[model samples]
Every structure is written in structure tokens, then in C-alpha cells.
Target chain A: MSDTADLTFLQTLRRVLHQERQIESGTVIYNLPVPFGFRSS
Target chain B: MQFALTEDQTAVRDMARGFADEKIAPHALKWDEDKHLPLDVIREAAALGIGGIYIKDDVGGSGMSRFDAALIFEALATGCPAVSSFISIHNMAAWMIDGFGSLQQRRKWLPQLCTMEKVASYCLTEPGAGSDAAALRTRAVRDGDHYVVNGQKQFISGGGVSDIYVTMVRTGAEGAGGISALVIDGKTPGVSFGANERKMGWNAQPTRAVIFENARVPVAHRLGDEGIGFKIAMAGLDGGRLNIAACSLGGAQAALDKSLAYMKVRKAFGKRLDEFQALQFKVADMATELEAARTFLWRAAASLDAKSPDASMLCAMAKRFATDVGFEVANDALQLHGGYGYLSEYGIEKIVRDLRVHQILEGTNEIMRVIISRKLIEGAR
Candidate 1:
């Protein structure tokens, strides 16, 4: 696994939620940063 | 504000709906009658590549967002919730193991799992631990290379039929700190399956009790650290709730669709049932609530996909609200159908029964309230 290949799960989540472009081919972008207020409810 | 489905989401959704119409709808009535859960149906679904939903492309997967998976479930569930739920549980099991398992573990298992060659179960609740999963007595003591697992899992979805169980057992002492997750293959010695549960509804999906009697799970099978099982399960449930909510949305959609078709032709005191202003109001209400829930479902799922701080709580809210609304809307649709809805042939009855369980499973509505309320009371939640 390359250095970039090992993105932490949360970091990967952040990128997916924040960015729209493909992280790689065929994988759907899953960028969804949870807002803080909703976290606190 | 833009809570609309993208072109891709819409395509997957339509494909799922079409697949269900062709594959699930005709047999749903008979499957319900025989109480035979066709595991092959699920295997065929897994072959679609939606089954490996959350896992990466490298691990025999076509990575898709949780939100996208939710869309698929809702669409299939619109045709047959029993089939949809079974697929959901299998996907749930696959997601956890894929997320936490080691590369060698992923390499060995993900291929079979993603492809639906083998099915997996998630075992957490026990005879004594329904809502209080942490109070579970299933224990796993360290014995060198293997952990000796001894415990019982209750209401296990895909129970006897599953090839593997991603189960939770206590590794340390007591309470939340002691629990850990381990993957156990069905062929393992000392592992046994309890009889399928006879339930109020959702009979087409077989749920049963599972007993782990000195089942030896390799240390390599252990997920996360010794004390991380509770956290792992909690995190999984946060998303699981959302997926279950999606199932509710699907079933509700099915019910509404049936009711709409019925109302257009069925006559009452007037030309047609839908011609009545009262019935029109009811239709309007169901549509309005469903619209709200669909948007909420996607927003919550998107939040989780983003890892937003509020993702978990939003998921809880979405699960609670969507399922509750689904139950109400489905019941009302049944009401609109009158005596015909009660008949098995209408299929509205089945949707009602299946959606009812949505309120209880994947973390009950009560637990959802607790989670939502806890978030409100605690700081930095």
C-alpha cells in the first residue's frame, strides 16, 4: 500500500464528503461532513 | 436545500425497483405463504455488486456510498421488504467486517462475501441483552492463539443461513469496556443455530437465535482491539439505523403506490375513492410526509457519508422519523384500501407487517429516542 493509499477512514470520509471529483475511477463520491449541531442534537 | 436524487442515484434506484418488480414481486405472496426465505434471491442480489456496497474496489467491491445503498434498499423494499431487509442485513455484516478486518482477512473473505458466495450475520443482542447489548453475557476469554467464545445471540437476522457471524463477546471483565467483535464461521465446532423465530410479521426473512458454545475464534478473527467492540457496534448501529430507515421508506413507497393504484379504480360513495375530497386529503398527507422523510433520509445518509459531527444523531433522527412516518403512511394506505387491504393478495397487508418491524429492528425507536435525547443533553456530543 502506498502512503496515499492508506488514508484513514475518517480522513477518507472527509475527502469524500468535502470534494466532488472522483477519488478513483468507479467509486462513488461519498462526501458528507456531519454538522456539529446535529451531532449535539 | 437540494434534496433531489442525482442522475446516478436515480439510475440505481430505478434499476433496483425494476429488478424487484421482475424478481421479487411475483413470488412475494408465495414466499410469505411458505415462510421460505430464499437465500439464493439474496445471492443473486449480491451478484449485482450492490451487496458489497461499502467495501473498497480492491477487495472485490465496487465502492458505493451508504446513501446510494439506502436508495437501492428502499427501491427493492418497495416491492418486497422481506427481500430488501435480508439484503440489508447481509450488507450490514459485510460493511463491518470490511471496515475493520485486516488485509489478509479482507483478502480471504471479502471476495466471497462481496460476491454473495457466502453470507454473514451480525450477532450482538442476546437472550438477556435486547436493548442493553452491553449487558450481554456472551464471553470470550483469551486462550493463546484463539479466543474461546461462549454465548448466545438472539433475534439474529439471516441466522442459520449465514455462512459467518461477525459476533460480539466480552474479552475483558464486565460492562461496556469488556466487549470485542470476532468473526466466526458457521462450520466452526461448538457453534450451533437455534430454530427460526416465529414473529408477528416479516416472516419471509428468517430470524433466529444463535448459540456459541466454546466456539474457537482465531485471534486473527478478532476485530479492532480488546475493548473496542462496544464502540464498533455502536458505530455500526449509527449507520445501520439509517439503512433500516431506508427500508421503511421503501416499504412505505410500495404501500403508497398500491393505494394510489387501488384508489383510482375502487369506487366508494362516489365515482371513485380518490374523487372524494377526504381521501384526497389523506393521499396528500401521505405524499407530503413521504417527501419530507425521503429528503431527511438522504440528508442524514449524506451527513454520515461526510463524517459530519452530527452524522450519527442525524441518522438516529432520520431512522426514527422516517420509520415512524413509514408506519403511519403504510397503515393509512391500508385503511384507504378498506377490506381489500386485509387480504393477502393485495400485498398491502404484507407491506404493513414488514414496515411495522422497521420500527423495532436495527435499534428500536425507543433506543433511537434515547440516542437523540442523549445527544441533546450531553455537551460535545
Candidate 2:
């Protein structure tokens, strides 16, 4: 709603994007695909 | 995944903060008013390994990372943005030499530069070419073992005061491809500096036009091969952009801190400013935006460290966003201070002024957008 809230949301989104990109490219620690709605054991 | 500073990074930041508090903050206003460059204080910072924060340890540097440098510059800027920004420019120039210079060149130049015994200036912008840097007109013609350099560089930060200049000169053709990088000794014959230019901010450091009239620079001083100066300069800008943005962040953070202090004590309408909900909301926005900018800057710095393909675009994004937000937040901090902020002694106005040029220099925010969009377009294709 506000610029502050917008930036916070954007930052969270960026982190998620970075995480997804790293996972897709196999740069992250885990090698398995992170399935949607799949909770880690 | 790392959202916080490492212990070492925090220690470095604290060290720089202590130095700024002791040596820089008290005299910042006087330095700005008198247009003084505190060479002694800078040398002291050099003693603390602040001079070569990210340069290699082999050449008397601290061998820190770009991320570490971001923390250092931001901390130093909390004392005075102008001085901190000058140090940033010096580091950029030194890094260009370390990154591209031959072993002999590095051995000769970097040692003194790392110690701040001989300060360095990056000479690229010309009277005709600010935004369009490739169009720079400074010429260097090959003459025996030396290149006869002849042209002027405009708005050089350490123009007259710096001991060496990392200069870009056109050697062959009409465009960027013909340009070559040369290290020119400050006292070289025909090397002269124009009168220091009066500027709106960053007055703590001198800004002047560097003039060269047939100054002979030895061929040995050249960085990399001829025809690659533009690439070198552009590479340097990747890190330079991050440092300048960090400086902006520091200045804004200082202003915000001051505003918080002012609001706590300064009463208005029989109530302290912090008690007002509207003003508190404004403070909230300032802190939020500042934090967001800081986080983005760290991402950019990390990208640079990892040599990521998107490093340049991310740097451009961070620079544009952080500098704009820095100025806005600092300006808002001033607004929160009311009329007191406008006065010189309050220091918030100085932060606002110093952060203004961060948007203009290091490739204007307009150029930043162009760089970002071009990358996006290219990536899509």
C-alpha cells in the first residue's frame, strides 16, 4: 500500500526469485527440484 | 540466503564507524564551509587499511571484498559524504591499476596508492562527454617510447591535489575502440590543473579540470592493450557505482539518525515530534526504504564479487534505486527537522547536498535505466 510496504514486499519477492533461480541452475545446496506445495521433511 | 553481515564485516564496519566518529564528523561542517580536503585524516584512514579496502594484499592493500568495501564506505560516509566519496574514487582508480596494470605497473603505483602516500584520480569525463563517455575527445598520439597526451578532463574529483591520474585517451579511431588507458604522473611536463571549480556539494574534496598539453606518458604506463580503455573504464564503473551508492546510504542513514534524535527531544505544540503519529509514519517509511536500498546494494555487491553475468545490470539498478532513495530519505529527514534542518549547523542539509550528485555521477540514473533495460531486452532474446 505504502512505499515502505511495497519495498518490503519487493525485497521478499527478490529473495524468492534468487532462491528459485539458484535452485533451477543447481547452485543451491540441495540438488532435487523444489516441487510446488512440497513441504520439506 | 545470507541476510546479515558476517562477524568480520561487522567488525570492519565498527572500526570505520569509530574512525569517522573520531576524525571526520566533528570537522565535516568546517571542512565543507572552508572547502578543505583533509589529507591527514585520509592518510590516517589509510593507516587503518581503509585506503585499499578491496585491493589485493600483495600490493599493500587490505585485500577485502566489494561487499566489505560497501560496509566501509557507508560507515565512513556517516561522518562526511564528500570525504567518503573521494576515498571511493581513489579506491576505484587504484583498483583499475591493480586489476589491469602489468606487474611492474602495479609494483610501482599501487604500493604508494594503497598507503595514500600518492592519491590517485580517475580521468575519464571530459567537457564534451559526461554521460556519453565513449565520445571523449582527449587524444594520445604515439611518439617513440611515449604517448604525447593532449586534452582536458573535466570535473576530476582530485584534479589538482591527486598525485597520479588514471587517464583514458583516444589513440586511434573515432569511438570507444580507439581509446587507451594511461597512468600519468601528476608532475609530468605539460600536465596542469585548472582552477578548482566551485560546486554545490562534495566541497570537502577539490574538483577541477585536468589539462594536458603534449604531456608525454611512457608506453609502459598503459593499462592492458590499446583500444580497450573503454572496457576497462566500464568495468571499473561496476564497482564504482556500488561504492557511490553506499556513500549515499551512509549519508541518508546519518540524516535519519539525526532526525530520530531531533524528534525525541524537540517539542512542538507542547509535545515531542516523535509523539505525533504522522511524523512517526514518515520515519517508518524512511527507515524501511533505507533498509530496502541497503539490501539491494548488498545483492549487487555480491553479484559483482561472484562475477555474475548480471552484475552490471544489478549494479546499475542498485545505484539508481539507492541514490534516489538516499536523496529522498535525507530530504525527508530534513523536512522532519523543520526549519532547523535548513540551517548549516544541523548537518542534515549537507547530507542532502552531498547525496544529490550521487544520482548524477557514476552514470546518471537515466543511464542506469538504459543499462538495466538493455540487459533485460538482451536476456529475453
Candidate 3:
């Protein structure tokens, strides 16, 4: 039972990672990171 | 990623499916019409190790994981959602004792509970407190070796028929901090039950108000220390939510399957219903949505099994989405059946009615949003 449950947990993590990759690919084209800027006095 | 079920999981699902088809489906309509709580059928299920699906094996339980429980419940609900959900409630109560009760408490209660010799009910909801569970007023005054319990729990499943009630009561000051959980015997003095409520659905199981007036429960019956009853109840609900969602999945899947079979045979305007492109698209959409909800539910179940930090939030999301989808799909299937679906003989209307309450119980979908949003905002901070 524990082994099956652990395998299911691993599968869930893989699904999450797969979804995150899809989101990341979309974000690269649509949501660029902003750079931090300092005031020059 | 392995999206498919392992061989062991498939075997478990098939076993439950066979039991449901042979034992539960043929009589579900009669049971619903007669409002019968089929203890014999329930005991049969218990014999198959369903009574303590996730409880530790030492106590005569199956000791399966939450994911396995999800699969078992979903398959069982294909036969009758009401029966399957009542079993879920019983397991939740037994698990409380196994998870929190002392060794003696577990020994005294679990074996009988696991074997279905003594059915259990969970007592947390009250007439005054539904969403705000922390506001529960059931009071348990410490008196020597026993706690004198007072106040009433409303809408308790298996209230009159159950042998034991895992109850929550206030022990100290007001609010959530004062609450404590107790495993109260059904035969205890001053413990009485109200009439079985006339409900919208889930008629196969009884729902009644459990009234306690000076009911004496042993101190040993307390699940945990004072001030954590609400916590325990909430924790139990995390898994309870998953099971209920799985029940929704099964019910919807059954309805969808019926729709497919019906459309194949029932003709319209000299052509079969399935021959129409629009109807085919509708069936396609239903199947897609059901699959999506089911996969999401499995993820939440896996998170629970892994004890992930966000398991609770994921559970709320799954419960909300799956139940809503379940209801919509069942209702749509009913529509697809046309006038025949409205008739009791077709069995589609019953599934629609049964799926409706899934949105309300195990914490309302609105409350699910509350839990999910709270986690989201907290994580943002």
C-alpha cells in the first residue's frame, strides 16, 4: 500500500512539473522579468 | 509522468466495480425509494476490507492510502452514491479513533468498527454552526472520570443507527480553543436522536439530529487533549473531502456511461441520438471534463498521501471543482436523456439529486473557496 501511494505521489509531482514547464514556456514570451534599479542621488 | 493506474490499482478498482455491479446497482433504486439503510450490504462491503480502508492494519483495517480510497469510493458510488458516502463517513470516524485515540481506545473500538459490527457517525455540525464550525456549542463538562456532554448535533449521518458517535464538544472557554472530541456510545444515558430528516437526496442513509443532555462519556473516550477538537475535525475533513469528490466522480461517470448507452439505442427522427453531430459534441465535452476533474482529484489524493504542505488547499480545490463538474455532468446527462431521464425508472434523476448535495456537504463549495483563498493570500505574504 505504501509503495503504491509513494508512486502516486511521484506521479503527481511529475504532472505538476509538466504543467509548470508549459507555464514557463508561455511566460518567457509574455512576461519578462524586470531589473532592479537604484536612484542616482 | 505515469498517468495510468498501476496493475494493483486496476485490480482494486475492478474488484470494487464488480461488487457494486452485482450487489449494489440492481437494488439501489429500491433502497432509495424505501429509504433503506442496508446494513447487510454495508457489512458485506466491510467484509471486503472497505470499512477501514485507510486505517492501520493492526486494527483489522485495510490500511490503504488515500489514493486507493479515492478509487474504491469512486467505483462504489457508481452503484449508489448514498451508500458509498455513508461508508466514507463511517471510515472517517473510525480513522479518528485510530489516528488520535489511545492504544486502549483503539483496541476497544477499532476492531468492532473495522468489522462493521458497530457503525460510527461523526458529530460536528450543529443547527447553529455549519460553516463556522468553531462556533459549535456542544459542551462536555469534566466530571470525575466521565464528561457530561450537552447540546445537539444536527444533520448527522447514521445518527440513530450508528453504534457510536465521534463527537465534538466544548470543554473550556467559548470558541474553537475550548472544543474537544469524544467517542460517545450510542447507548449512553441521556443520548437521544431526532426524527430522520426528509432530505433532497442521499435517502438510502438516515440523517438525524443527535441530542445530548447530560450524556456521560468516559474521559478515555476523548480523541486528543482539550482545545484541538476543531483541528481534528478539520483534518478528518481533508480526506473526507477527497472521498466525497471521488463519490461525485463515480456518480457523474455512471451518468455519462448511461448517456452513452442510451444515445446508442434511442432514436430521434428516424436516426439514432448518437448520429447527431451536436449531441456527439456534447458527449465529447462531458467525457473530457469528467476526465479532467478525475485527474485533478487524483493529484489532490496523492498530495494527501505524500503529506504535502499544500495538501489541504489542494483538497479544497479538488472538492470544489470535482463536485461542481459532477453535478453539471449529471444534469447534462439527464437532459440528454430527455423525458425518460425525468422518470424514476431510468435512474438518471437520482444521480442528479444525489450529486447536488455534494456541493453543500463536506464544507460548502463557497467555504472551499474561503479555505483556498486564505492559503493563497497567506502564501503571498
Candidate 4:
């Protein structure tokens, strides 16, 4: 849900695509701002 | 080309996600282990208005759009595919009844269905008729104020557990024209159910053969006219296919999420597995494919809501593509997990198993391609 206005299409694609898989050294860091809550009644 | 979801849809999706995570995720494995159909859990979900999501609000339903329902299913499936798929079946029957049933029939069924006080199942596929549904052999002879039905329906989800069955019966002639949609109470006399079927997946719900031996149903239970059952069944399937596709997307997304988490912590060659370019490429491809499938399914759902001429064809295409991609993504996610993926404790293997049937149900993927081809040929003329 982040703004992609400044990034190029390819760059935006990479960032959006790998955002969940971003790793720092041996530790895994999930940068997704959205919580696991997608279920609405 | 609009990728954004409306506020209402997003709210529904989020509510479904929260409910799934709290109610379904923690107990999915247990349900699978015991082969338990959690009717209580399902009823809780229905209390949220998903039971009759697409039905008019005037009839106690949410009156949501097909796209909105698709989004909700995807989010729910993130908790458990089997549970979500069963919910989809319930919605399919509820929608059919609301759309085709007489005003009196709606008054009798929709309130309870909307509240999930009564559960419903669809009876279209028979033992002899799977792909060729038009050739179904279930007969319903009209006898005064009631119809005596003598036939069998197979692969019915929530078969023994459902309270109402939206059934397709042969009423008049042969082929499609003879078919008529009937609402039969599941507890009717002479209506019996076979033993629960053991399947490769979808274990959270029961699948059984519904046997009708001279079951007497009132004439007033018929939906629409007598000869339009096949059309009603097909129309229901158009939305059913989208829901099944959405369930696949949710399963694959879960698998991908698990894989990404595993790759970050798991080590190989004295470094993180995700640091390798080959594995990164795989992750990238999985993400891209899943994203593409989700967006395409949204478009198909929108087309269905619009009642476009090509809605059926688009539904076929979306179901075929999304299910295929979902399976592939889940399989790849399993491979990424190495040995741990095969184990039940990790849950990756469960997603792969659950998603395998999405291609087979709601019409096989091969049938989907055939539909697309036929539509293309017709459009050319």
C-alpha cells in the first residue's frame, strides 16, 4: 500500500514483489505494512 | 486496469482474514485430522452475512457484488481452503435460491440461510455424470402437488450435514431442457446419504453421495420454471468457479508466505538460503505469478458482476489459470522448504494437497480451456 509514484515500474515491481522476502543477514525481515487481517464480515 | 480495492471490499476482506486467523487457522489441522465438518464454525462465519453475500439485502443477505465475495473468499482461504471452499458452496446455493426461487421460497429460506441457521448444498454432479452434467440421470416425476424424485447425486459437499439441497432433476424431456432446479429439504423422507468419501484433500468438510429414493418434494419448491435447471446450475457455477479460484490464490499465498519465512532463517552453504540468486529468482517468479492470478481473478469477478456476455468464458479462463498457478506455486514452496516441507507440522504440504482439487472441481481445467476455445470461435463469427 506504499506510494510508488517516485519509483520506476521495474523498481516498483521488484520492491513490491520481494517486500515479503527481504532478509537482513541471516534474519528474515518482512516489510509488509499490511497485517494478516484481510477477513471482513 | 484498476488494481485498488474499494473501501467496502477491503473491509470485508479484512474481517474475513481476522475471523479466519482466529477461528480456522489454529484448528484447520485438527479438523483435517478428524475429518470434522465444523458446522459451528461455519455458522459463526455465516452470522457475519457471508451466507447470502450476493443475495439482495432486502432478503437478509449482504447484497454484495461477485468481486466482493471473491475477495472475501480469498482472505478466508488464507486460514483454510477446505473450510473456505465449503463456504463458497453454501454461498452458491444461497445465491441460486435468492435469484431463481419464488418470492415465497425466498421468504422461507433466505432468513435462516443468511444467518447460517440452516446450511445448504448443491446437487448437480452425479456418479455417472461428472464433466457432462447435462447428461444427468436423476429423475423427478411430477405427481400432482409434489414431485417424486428417484435418483442419486454424488460428490456433494456438506451432503449429510446440510439442511437444504439445491438439486437439479430431470423433469420433462432429455438433455438440458429436461432439467429442473428443486429445493429439497435434506431431512426429507427417503432422502439418504452414503458414507463419507475419503479424498486426497478437502478433509475439513464431508463429501457424500446423496441418494433420493422416491423422495417427495412439494411442487412449490421448484426454482424459476421447470426446464431451466441446467441454466441455473451453470450460472451458479460461474460464481462457484471464481470462489474456488480465490481459495486457490489464498492457499498459494500462504505457502509463499511460509516459504519466504523459512528461507530467511534456514541456512545453506554457510549463508541464508534466500541470499542465493537461484532461490531469489524462484521466489520472485512465485510472487509474480500469484499477483497476476489475483488481479486476473478480480477482473473475471467484475465481469461476472457486470453480467457481460463473455462472463462465463472469463470465469473459465480465470479458474483454469489461477488454479494451475496456485498449485505450481504451492509445489515450488514445498521444494523451497526442503525436507521440512513434506512434514505435516510445517503446513506447506497441506496447502499443496488442498489446492490440487481446485483444478478438478467446478469443472475440470480441461473443460475450462474448451469453454474458452468455444467462446473464441463464437466471437470470431
> Number of the top candidate by lDDT?
2
Q: Write the per-residue lDDT of candidate 3 for residues B1-381, one digit (tens) a residue.
A: 578996447656776776788889899999999999999998877766688888777667776889989998999999999999999999998988988888889989998897799999999999999999999999999999999999999999999999999999999898888999999999999999999999878999999999999999989889989888988998899999999999999999999999999999999999999999999999999999999999999999999999999999999999999999999999999999999999989999999999999999999999999999999999999
lDDT per residue (tens digit) for residues B58-117 in model 1: 776657788888888887888788888887877788878888888888898888888778
Give the fraction of true interface contacts kept by model 2: 0.00
Q: What TM-score is obtained for chain B in each of the predicted models? A: 0.97, 0.99, 0.99, 0.99
When summed lDDT is taken over every stretch of 10 residues in candidate 1 chain B, the lowest stretch is B6-15
Worst 10-residue lDDT window, candidate 4 chain B: B6-15
Q: Which residue pairs in candidate 1 have backbone atoms (N, alpha carbon, C) closer than 3 angstroms, thus clashing? A: A16-A31, A17-A31, A17-A32, A32-B306, A33-B306, A33-B308, A34-B308, A34-B309, A39-B310
Clashes of 1: 9
Q: Model 3 off-target regions past 4 Å?
A: A1-41
Q: What is the Å distance of residue B29 in model 3 from its true position?
A: 0.4
Q: What is the lDDT of residue B355 in candidate 1?
A: 87
lDDT of 4 at B225: 95
lDDT scores in order: 0.81, 0.89, 0.88, 0.88
- Fnat values, one per model, are 0.00, 0.00, 0.00, 0.37
Stretches > 4 Å off in candidate 4:
A1-41
TM-score, predicted candidate 1 vs. hidden true structure = 0.89
How is the predicted docking of candidate 4 categorized under the CAPRI scheme? incorrect
DockQ of each: 0.04, 0.02, 0.01, 0.15
